[model samples]
Target chain A: MSDQNKSLDPRIARLELPQGESIVKPDEYWGTFEVFLQEKRGKFHQHVGSVHAPEQEMALVFAKEQYARRGKCVNMWVVKTTDIFAFQLADEDMFATTPDKQHREAGMYKVRDRIQEYQNRQK
Target chain B: MYGGGFLPEENPKKQTETVAEDPALLADFQARIDRGEKIEPHDWMPAMYRKQLIRMIEQHAHSEIIGALPEGTWITRAPGFRRKMALIAKVQDEIGHGHLLYTAAETLGKPREQMINDLLSGKSKYSNVFNYPAITWADVTVIGFLIDAAAIVNQLANSKGSYGPYCRALERICAEEAFHLKQGHDAFVYLATGTPQQHEMLQAAVNRWYKPIIHFFGPSDKESVHSEQLMRWKVKMASNDDMRNQFLDMYVPKVREVGIDFPDPNLKKDPETGKWNFSDPDWDEFYEVINGNGPCNAERLAVRKWAEQKGRWVRQALATPYTKSTVPLA
Candidate 1:
């Protein structure tokens, strides 16, 4: 009912501050875009954070300010988070490969040992 | 300082006591935490774990948003051009930090709009310190220097915490806070070492803020109804008492070195135990302020409500019909 609550901050005190008027529906927000930042020219643009925006261009604008304000950013990319087809974190086990794939490993076939054996066989 | 995540202990049963999750999944999750791995958004976390993290992160996000206002009020009134520019940057950084924390919280299933609604309707709590008014430039210096220093202590500890997104957000926030602390400390030192009038104003501001500073780290461990599972999960990196002691040990000397004395006569550390002792900062006042009866609580929420209400049209206009907003996968 009051124009403004009595505030020590003069600006607030002078304004007609509104109260109890927020009615944002659950889906009434701009979509979230995941922001990736490249620290330098040669670096990969790693996902730093996300920003909510109306479109791709605005997302990049917001992403630059929010994620790259402090860092030495050469470039940035913004992709809608909904666009990302990510594997669930619980499926981390799926990415695990058997360590016993020794045949596939470079260090498995030891050239040093083979050379030593060949010289000994010659002797 | 932004105090750690807090929920009132009224519902102790639902809050921390019972484990209602599947034992096998819970054990697997606990094992992952024990191995020093972060809990990502889609991980099979215990219900209690998800609930508590959401509450804590949401509280932290709200604190960052509301925390900007007290110092922000001083931007136009800042004494010099340089101070004004620094204050402006610091305020923007605080708002940006709030957005980062909100995104982090969203990964845990709560929507950002809902969080804002809860904050506006007073269903959630933020750091209690922000409810106090910054009446003078000296108050701004105290907040910028000391309060931010305290936040860094809490936030650094939280950055080592188990939650992935929250830790990442805190890392960025803590980095930016360095500039805020330095600028604040410079101004506080100027006031402390300046003329008698400046010194008097600084002292008065310190006296007003001393109790809130003590209340910054939440209740001491003895009084707090915290769960041990939170500690085991790395959700809580340190106890409230340990953090308070650390803050005092690091900062008491800094304040004393500049000839600005804390209002308490009994503030001192015991050489034997390395613990500082001081007069009781009224826990009653702490509780009352948190319950929305503080000097600036009404004003703070009122202003926040205004922002949400005023900004609604732009957000609504920007909403696209085909866009589907989902939880961020990080």
Candidate 2:
């Protein structure tokens, strides 16, 4: 409001803003939700980013504004960040299939090649 | 978006200067980085890495927020209907960028409110360029064109950085920047090739903005504390000087082709060395502006503080039992 804080832009000058310190309270930004984006009709929704909103509907709106603004996003899904179960990044090696379970892998069945060899031997 | 030149203030007591960590864990962290794996928010990391990233990302977010203020001043006065729409869209994108980045930084444990408090209280810094005013439409274009380009260079390199959340945020920010750059270039070219008065206006803007543009990347790497460990950790993807040079290399010709160039006569490429050499941009002014003494520094902070104060009721009215927020899991 004073000459000391006078701004060049008329809009700011009009606000007559007083100069001082102000603090925002914790959680003033609200809860978080992970946004999932589907680029096309047949594509699966992949997690892109998170948005802070009070509820799922507002979360979807914010997600659209944030993640889908510049890209080809056909649809979006918003779930509370708290809902997703995640494994520890350090435990990444646990997901790998052990070599002993090769029988369960389709590639491990070499029966077709073995049959070819037996047929050739019979010939 | 214009986020670097941040070497965390070094104190002899503790900083990047020295911090002892468990060697085995440090090695594993360093190895992960070396192998180009992103360090996620939940993963184990060095205290220094977390601190540095929090500072850089927070600073960047603050930059995007404040960076919009100067341009937001011009929406009513933009030359035509299309430019008005473009400017409005670009400004919104910038604010959106700030919000996205705050979330990214929050994942590192500092809450978004704390970051806002820091910004309002002047405990942190944003890009120094926003402290300057956009005196004319030409000035806004310069900011949209050159400042955005500079940010892209800084951010593109940062997108390759080892932190997962930061890299993700930068990827999104950079995507929208293309439109901002094109809109800026179109406006700038129109003025450059238009009437003599328009040409003069744009020229004056370029003359005034060149020094700040030079300062935008931060202090020279040679003058500042050497952040070798940060580079090794991928916290710093490129040196400040390197990013500055890259900007000048890409943009100088673009400016010159339009019959206007930066004011510095010493600004030229040494064909022998393939590097641009420009006069010293007066680092003291840069530091002075950063310490809150520039032309518009007071106005900028004052406006930000006022917005927060005025918006208090809305925040409170909206605050349900849900107001107890937690840091987002990335």
DockQ per candidate: 0.61, 0.67
Predicted structure with the largest lDDT when compared to the true one:
2
Candidate 1, residue A81: how far the Cα is off, in Å: 1.0
Task: Pick the DockQ winner.
Answer: 2
**In model 1, where do residues sit more than 4 Å from their true spots?**
A1-5, A98-123, B16-19, B223-225
Candidate 2 residue runs with Cα over 4 Å from true position:
A1-5, A98-123, B7-17, B223-226
TM-score of each: 0.94, 0.94
Backbone clashes, candidate 2: 0
Write the residue-wise lDDT of candidate 1 on B242-288 in tens digits: 88899999999999998888999899999999999989999999989
Report lDDT (Cα) of residue B128, candidate 2: 93
Give the per-residue lDDT of model 2 (tens digit) for A1-123: 357647778888888676566878778878899999999999999999899987788889899998887759899999999888988988988867576698788888778888999999999
What lDDT score is found at residue B129 in candidate 2? 95
Q: Candidate 2 lDDT, tens digit per residue, B82-160?
A: 9999999999999999988999999999999899999998888999999999999999999989999999999999999
